[model samples]
Target: MTSPTRILILEDDDGLRTSLRLVLEDEGYAVFEASDAEKALLTVEDPGVDLMLVDLMLGGMDGFSFIARARPRTEAPIVVVSARDRTEDIVAALEAGADDYVTKPFSVEEVQARLRALLRRPTIGDAETEDADDDVLTLDSRTPLLFDAGAAVLRRGEEEVHLTQTEFRLLSVLAEHAGKVLTRTALLQHVWDQDYFGDERIVDVHVRRLRKKLEVDSANPQILVTVRGLGYRLDTA
Candidate 1:
């Protein structure tokens, strides 16, 4: 039998962490809890961990530092659950390696849905059918960047590129519609599988992140280009 999806919850707030654990356990996940970033780091390295829920304000080390440190250890998606609602905070968390972000006072349903969406995402080497037309997309010939959909991997020549789940999803959507400018709204719906209105910055952040990986020069991106006042397009040509 397939093992239950493992989720690590790192929050200093005892009440909130316990409540989240109860709710998540009830939903059939293999939930693990940590009251601080230091403890969470101990669990983040486990390859069995499928996801992580982290709070920014934590005793010692902070959530951002934990995420940055843990990122190289595991490919599991990290979702920041914090009271910070500012755009800068969200962007900072994403920059620090968070796959997604949730603000304080968020509903249990929203948190659950976010986790479900993240866990449902296909990982590299997952045996799954392709949804896009081309199973492999060539981003640039010179740089030799390619996204192999069936393998759930992006490669630059012989080297396999490491990408966060959210980043992969964003690239997949853009690759499926290569040469077509997709608005931030459409990208949000397709990649995140949510309306996520007014949070287009999420797309922008991931796109910037992707550019760093997919382009030789992120500052002068050609493969993934943004259209002025419109949106973004992945040029396979």
Candidate 2:
């Protein structure tokens, strides 16, 4: 059997922590709780943890500091759950190694969905099947493919590809399904988290950016190739 996904919640607020523990446990995740950065560090010592949800404001060391210290020790994805809603706060958390962020008063379902998506994401070398086209795209076998469900940092071989948040999510959805040709609408829905009234240019611009990062010669692409009149596919051949 596949091991259970372990999740750590580091929030100083007792009520929020308790509620998250209850809700996430009900969602069938192994939950660990910590009220401060100090305890969070200790909790992460257990290698079984698959992901983390940390609050930006803690009693002593803030979540950003905790992330700075903890990142070197673990490869688990961290998602910041905080009351701070400013753009600066979000940017800071992402810069500090958080894979995602959630604001206060958010729905439990949304949080759970985001967590599931992050956990479901195949990091570098887990097993993956080829699409119907018989194309097999594998992430770099040498290094772990770090993804922050909120931003795009594509690592093709040895170089890290810098991408905007939108571009990152767009590439991530495609990378997850490496050899498949995803439709424009499917990309918009899954990556943009929206369904209707979307601009196709949004997809084009991000795909261009992703290609620039993933391809050795962007002018003559190799990895992210376009299918005529259909969409795009990560050439896994």
Candidate 3:
């Protein structure tokens, strides 16, 4: 039998942490709880931790610091659960290496759905439909940037570029529908595998992050171009 997926909950609130643990456990996940960043860091590196739900406001270290510190230790997706709903706070969490963010007073169903989506292994093309040519995605024939989906690696000529799971998935989806304008809603559905969650800025923040890594000049991107009132399109010319 397959081992259960483990999730770590780092929250200072006893009630919220326990409630989340119980909910996740009821869903068949092996849940672990931590009251602060220090405690969470103790086990965050464990390979058993498949995902993490982190609270931004903690006792000792803040969530942003925990995320930045933990990001280098594990590739497990971290979802920030906090009361801060400002766009800047959300962007800061993502910039600090969080894969997703959920404001407090969020529904259990929505949290569960987000967890499920993050846990699902997204791929550009599985073995069944994969081709030699399909393995690599390039912005242009002359460009050195390449996305090797099969290997799950992005390369710029001889150099390998590192990407977080969310960034990689976003790029994969865009590459799958190259040259097509994909609205924020479409991207959220395909990348995060969720319906409207009321914040499209999540998409914009991630896209900006991707541009910084993929484009020579993120401010004047030539590849991932934004369509004024429509959306974004990957110009793989």
C-alpha positional error of residue 208 in candidate 3 after TM-score superposition, expressed in Å: 0.9
User: CA lDDT of 138 in candidate 2?
Assistant: 44
Q: Give one digit per residue, the lDDT tens place, for model 1 in 59-132.
A: 78999899999888888898899999998999999898888898998999889988887777655555542544
Please, what is the TM-score per model?
0.90, 0.60, 0.91
Candidate 1 weakest lDDT stretch, 10 residues: 124-133
Q: Give the whole-model CA lDDT for all candidates, comma-separated.
A: 0.84, 0.70, 0.84
Position 200, candidate 2: lDDT: 52
Root-mean-square deviation (CA) per prediction: 2.2, 8.0, 2.4
In candidate 1, stretches whose alpha carbon ends up further than 4 angstroms from where it belongs are 129-142, 194-198
lDDT of 2 by residue, 5-85 (tens): 899999988998999999988878889999989888988986547899999888899999999888777778887888898
lDDT of 3: 0.84
Q: For candidate 2, what is the total of clashing residue pairs? A: 3
Deviation (Å) of 142 in candidate 3: 9.1
